[model samples]
Target chain A: MRYVLFLYAAIAFVVLAAGSIILPDWAMFLFAMALAKGLVCLGIVAMMRGGVVSFGQGLYYCIGAYTATLAANMWGLSDIFLLTLLSSAVCLIVGVIFGPMLATYRGIFFAMLTLALSMVLYGTLSKMSVLGGSDGLNIAPPTFLGWAPEGRDLQTALYIYVVAIVVIAGTLMRIYFDSEQGLITLATRDNELRVEYLGASVRKVMAYNYIFAAVLGGLGGTIAVLALGHVDPEFAFWTTSGEFVFVAILAGYMSVPAVFVAAIILEVVRSFSNLYFPNTWQLSLGIFLLIVIVTLPNGLGSLLSRRKGGKT
Target chain B: MSAGVLEVRDVQKTFGAVTAAKDISVSVPKGAIYSLIGSNGAGKTTFVNMVTGYIKPDSGEINFGSRNIAGLAPRLITRLGIHRSFQIAQLCNELTVEENMLLAGAIHHDERPSFFRHAHSAAARERAMATLERFHIAEHRNRLIPELSGGVKKLLDIAMAMAGETQVMLLDEPTSGVAADEKFPIMDLVIEALRAEGVTVIFVEHDMDIVTRYSERVLAFYDGQIIADDTPDEVLLDEKVQRYVTGGPA
Candidate 1:
């Protein structure tokens, strides 16, 4: 049954890659950006499974973008794969440093601490004149294993690359959620005392989850920077983190695929509202969120889960 | 006495002005079933908490086997072979009964839980099912905790606690919320299961009937101290136990 899910994911990946050839350049870029942001939301979903909602995920997101951009600019490393690897490694180390401390907190304290950390990053980045300061830095177009695709080809290459990464990440996350450690996390969410009495360390579980979320956030930032061609302090800003939280809540933690789907829906709504309403796009998004929350309290994932007549 | 499996010596615990445990000490013989009887705030739960590492005694030596387990974290104590159940059944309300048992089995059986191994692997499922069957709750294995009857929840809670390698099992009011008719049946099932595994059973109770029926020995508590420690019949006849604990004729 698990392998069957992976097979379906592979098929979806192939279709998305093949179908990208017919999409216009602008549409491809938009979708790539949406998927990149979806990766960040995936990190939030991982932590959510352990009963934590990080409000400062943008801290890792911004760090990843800056890591990739700085490595490319200073070291002249232009390969997308190498840049992503570097960003993930850096984020992993940072996560180790912070995860233990963050793991000690829960509920509003955890939320506020994460938010504070991201805001600190935003503030620090804004004052650093060497790394473009408040205006941020622009990244050079990426090459794929020495093959530099140009014009519309570049957009398609990036779209396909993002699609591949999402498939791999999503599949691994699904497996993780089914693992023994994963079930322990879900148990911790329900009764931490019982989990402790059962001889599993709740703190250790929470710490490991925090580290995983950080790596996912970093991966998302790397992809976003590659597609957007820009990295700025705003990536670590409160509003940026808020948007990721919005996607997480909208997707629900039950399904991995629902996360990206929710992200795409948000992007589409934002794009259309920006184009048509121009000034009231935020209000439009607010109303859309209200509708989703009222109609589906468990988020879009519950709709499919309910049809199957089982909890995921 | 057969070698004591759990030995508590001069344990002291004070919560602000109230003395919860004052120089209390007891040695539980291996494989013996002991019942603790006390009124509310009489420090019955406090003693359990101290032994299980939920509340560290102000000063004491809690020796389980050869190790002093006092002041240790609950998880560490649990891993060291002392497991416990709550007065109110502690269970994952969102997960099914089998899943809860599977989680406990996975954690206890493996040196450490695997990140990639499926939680409901064939081996884990088999173990979970066996434990459930032993407790006579196999029929409700797929039902969620909230959906189970109070008696079933209590049974499942005790079953989960028994999932690990336990030398000593502390059951805090195991039959508290259970129906009167169901209490004896539940106690019989629990004591039989624990006895079959050679686990030392220490349970707290207000039900004198249950105390006399299931336990070979009884400890009566009053004002944070043990007033009577003897066979069930002898403890029931003590003057202090009569006035302070069971409210029976002295």
Candidate 2:
């Protein structure tokens, strides 16, 4: 059954990767950006499974973007692969330092603490003119390994790159969601005391989850920076984190694939609503969210799980 | 007495002015079944809590083997082989019966849960099913906790506690919310299962009938202290126990 899921994921990856051949340049960029945001939301979904919602995930996202941009602009590094690895490494270290302390909090306290941490980063970044304070830094087009692709080909390459990362990360996350530690996380959500009495450290499980979320958030930030060609303090802004949380709520905790789907849907909706409604795009998004909440309380993922008669 | 598996000495716990446990001391022999009887707030649950590391005693020693586990965390104590069931059945209501059992198996059967291995691996599933079958709740393995009857929840609670390598099992009101007619059957299943595994059993109960039937020895509590410690018949007939604990004729 696990192998079959992996196979399905591989086939989906192939189909999505093929889209770069037919999609227009603008559409490619939109999809790439959406998938990048989806990675950030995926991290939030991971923490949500452990029964805590992070309101300030932008801390890692901003850290990732800044790390990649500074490496490129300051150190003259241009390899996209190295940039992502460096960003993820920085986020991992930050997560390790903070995950344990955050794991000790729950519910609203956890939410507020995470938000506060990100806001502090926002304040710090806004003041640091060396890394481009409010105006931010623009990223140069990146080279894939040693090959540099530009124009439409560059967009296509990036789209495929984002798809590859999402596929690999999503598959690995699905496996984690089915593992013993994963089950323990679900149990912790229901009754933490029972989990502790059963001899599993609830805090340890939560801290590990937070760290995973941070790395994924960092990866997402790197991808977003690569596609957008800019990095700024706003990456760590509370509103930016709020958007990730919004996607996470829309995706639900049940299905890993649902996260990217929700992100793409959000991007498409925002684009069309802004184009047509212009003045009321936020209103449209608000109404759309209300409808989804009223109809699918567990989010878009539950619909698929309900049909399959099992949790993904 | 056969070597005591759990020894509590001069344990004291106070919540402000009220003393919940006052210099309480008891030695539970290996493989013996002991029952704790007291009114609400008389410290029966408090004793269980202190022993299970849920509450650290204000002052005293809780010796499990030679280790002093008084101030240890609950998970550490549980990992050290002392497990307990709550007065109210604590269960993961969102998960199915088999999933709940599988979680217990994964945590206890393995030193640490693997990140890549499935929680419901064939071996883990088989162990979970065997434990469920031992308690006669195997038929409800796929059912959710809310779907089960009170007695079944009680049974599953004890069954999960026994999933590990336990030397001592503390059951806080094992039959509290169970129906009167179902109490004996649940106790019988629990005691038999624990005994078969050679686990030392200490249960808190208000049901005198259950206490007298299952416990070879009884400790009667009143106002945060043990007033009588003897065979069930002797403890039930004590003057102070009759007045303060059982409310029986003196």
Candidate 3:
């Protein structure tokens, strides 16, 4: 059954990629950006499963983006793979440094602490002229192992690259969600005391989850910066973090694939609402969230499960 | 105290002006079913908390098998062969009973705790199922936590702790929320299971019948002090216990 689902996902991804070749350039760009944002939602889902709702994942996101952009500008390192590795490594270090503080909080305290940290980053980024300040830095177009795309081919390459990365991430994430650490992390959300009593270190587990979330956030930001060709202070803003949270809630922590679906849905909704309502996109999102909260408290992921009352 | 597997000496804790525990000392022998009985606010739970390393005493020594573990983290204490079941039944409300059991089994038995290994590895699943079967909760293994009865939840709570290398098990109000008629059966299964594993069991219970029926040794607490400590019959018959605890000699 699992293999069949994987095969189905592969076929769907192939279809999506094939379809993207014929689609308009703007649509392809939007799709890539959505997939990039989806990566951030994946991290949010992981943290939420561990009883944490970070309001500052954008901190790591911004860090990842800046690290990639800065590394390119300073060291002339523009390889996609190298940038991904560097971003993840930098975020892991940041996560470890912040792990102790994150471990000391839970619930709203954790949420607020995370928000404060992100705001600090935003404030710093906005003031640093070397980083282009509020204007931020523009990232050089990335090459795949030395093969740089030219003009129209850039969109095609990026679109395919994102699809492949999202697929790999989604597949790996599914396995992770089924792994021992994932189960324990999810269990901690319900009862930290019981988890501790069972012989697992709650603080250690939270730290691990925090780092994992940070790595994901960093990866997502790296992808976003590469796709958009720009990295900015606004990427670390509380509202940006709130947007990730919004997608996570829309996606639910039930399954890994939900994150991608939620991100795409969010982007599509935002684009349509921005075009149609102009001034009421936020209002539209708020209403959508209110409805999801009321009708499907577990988020859209619950819709995939046939088992009633079985929490994902 | 030489023969005791778990020992507490001169433990004292005070929250503000209220003394939750004062000069509390007790020794629990290996493979013994020890019960602590007291009224509400009598520091029974506080004693359990201190022993389990949930709360640190201002001054005391808690030695589990020769190691002084007074201020250790709860996980370290638990890893040192002491496990606890909460009074309110601390469990993963979003997970199934078997999942909870498997989590306990994996944490307690798997030292490396691999991220690659599936949580329900064959060994873990079998162990979880066996533990559930031992507690007569096999029927509810697949059920979500909130679906189980209070008696079943209480039993599962204790049963989950059995997954660990439990040399000493502390149970706080094991039968508190359970139905009166189902209490003894749950306690009987719990005691039998622990005895089979040679676990030294220390439980804080308010029910006199449970204390008398299950405990080999009973410690009666009054005003944050052990007013009586003896065999069940002797502790139950003490005048201090009679007046303050049992409301008169039975």
Candidate 4:
């Protein structure tokens, strides 16, 4: 069953990569950015499955972008792969340090505490002048093993790279969802007491999950900075985190591929609305969310899953 | 006191003005079937909670094989070979019976509980299947938990607990939601299953029939203390126990 999903993903990404050559620069850039945001949404889905909805996911997102920017500027580290790895390393370290506090909380307390943490980052970043303050940092063009693609080539390479990363990460996360550690999230959400009695620490399970979410969110931020060639304090803003949560709700936590699909659809809708409706993009997004909630309560993936005759 | 496998040394707990447990003490011998009986608000559940590490006594000792586990975390105590089921059949409602059982088996894995290892390994699958069959729920393995009846859920709850290496099995009202006719059969099967594995059974039960029939010893609780600890016949016939716990003629 997982093999089929992987095969479908490989085929889909291959088609997308091939299509990137013919696709307009703007279209490719937009899609790549959407996939980057999908990584953040995927992390949110992981936390959501564990019965936690972090409204402050932007905290790690900003940390990744800022870390990549700082490393590139201070040390001349411009490898895209290294930047991505650095984002994960930084977020993981932060997660381990803060996870104990966050994992000890649940429900609204968990959500609000996450939001508060992200807001603290936002405040700190906005006030710090050396780190670019409110205007944020400009990233140097990233090199791929000493080969830096220029202009259109850069866009094309980035599009393909982002797609490949999302596909690989999605597949790995899907395997995790099927594994024991993954199923324990459902148990943790269902009955924390029962999971404890079963010889698993609920807080530790949640703490590890929080760290995973942080790493994924940080990875997304790194990719986003690479795509845009800039980073800002706004990345840690509450509304930015809210947008990721919005996409997670639109995607549903049931399937891994659903996260990417949701992110792409959201980006398409937002861009198209910004082009057509001008001032009503938020309104359009709100309407889209309402429709999804009222019609497909489990999100668009449930619709696709039902059509394929698979479990939702 | 040291002779028993599980011993409680004057455990005490208080919630503000109300005292849930106060200087309570008891010892459970190895492989012994003991029933705890009391009226509502009699501190029976609180006692069970403390024994299982869900509640920490204010000032007392909980010795499981000479290890003082009074303030230990519930999972640590669980790892110490003590397992329990909830009174309300707490389960992963969205998952299939097989998945839930496999989760229990996976946690018991000796690989230091890693995500890198396959959760549904061949060994874990074999153990889950074997246990499911033993509990007579193999046919419902693929079925989601919400589809199962109350009795089956209760049975599966206990079955999931037994998936690990348990020395002491704490069942909180195992037959509460079960039908009257199915209650005895469920208890009989559960007690038999646990005893077959040489597990010491300590269950909280409100039903007199289940207590008098299945348990060799009974602990009667009243006003946050153990009023009687003796054979079922003697405890049930005790005048104070009958008046306070069983609501007999004062």
Query: Candidate 1 at residue A200, lDDT?
Result: 92
Per-model root-mean-square deviation over C-alphas: 1.4, 1.4, 2.0, 2.4
Provide TM-scores for the models. Answer: 0.98, 0.98, 0.95, 0.95
Give i-RMS (Å) per prediction: 1.3, 1.8, 1.0, 1.9
Clashes of 1: 0
Q: Which sections of candidate 4 miss by over 4 Å?
A: A1-9, A304-312, B120-123
- State the lDDT of candidate 2 residue by residue for B1-250, as single tens digits: 5889888999999999999999999999999999999999999999999999889899999999999999899999999999999889999988999999999998997568988988877988999999999999999998888888999999999899989999899999999889889999899889988989889999999889889999989998889999999999999889999999888852
- Compute fnat per model: 0.84, 0.86, 0.81, 0.63
CAPRI-style quality class for the chain A–B interface of candidate 4: medium
Winning model by DockQ: 1
Mind giving the per-residue lDDT tens digits that candidate 4 earns over B126-202?
Answer: 88999888888889988887789888899899999998789999899999988899898888889999999989989
Q: Which stretches of candidate 3 lie over 4 Å from their true place?
A: A1-9, A306-310
Q: Which runs of model 1 end up more than 4 angstroms from their true locations?
A: A306-312
- The 10-residue segment with the lowest total lDDT in model 4 chain A: A303-312
Candidate 1 clashing pairs?
none
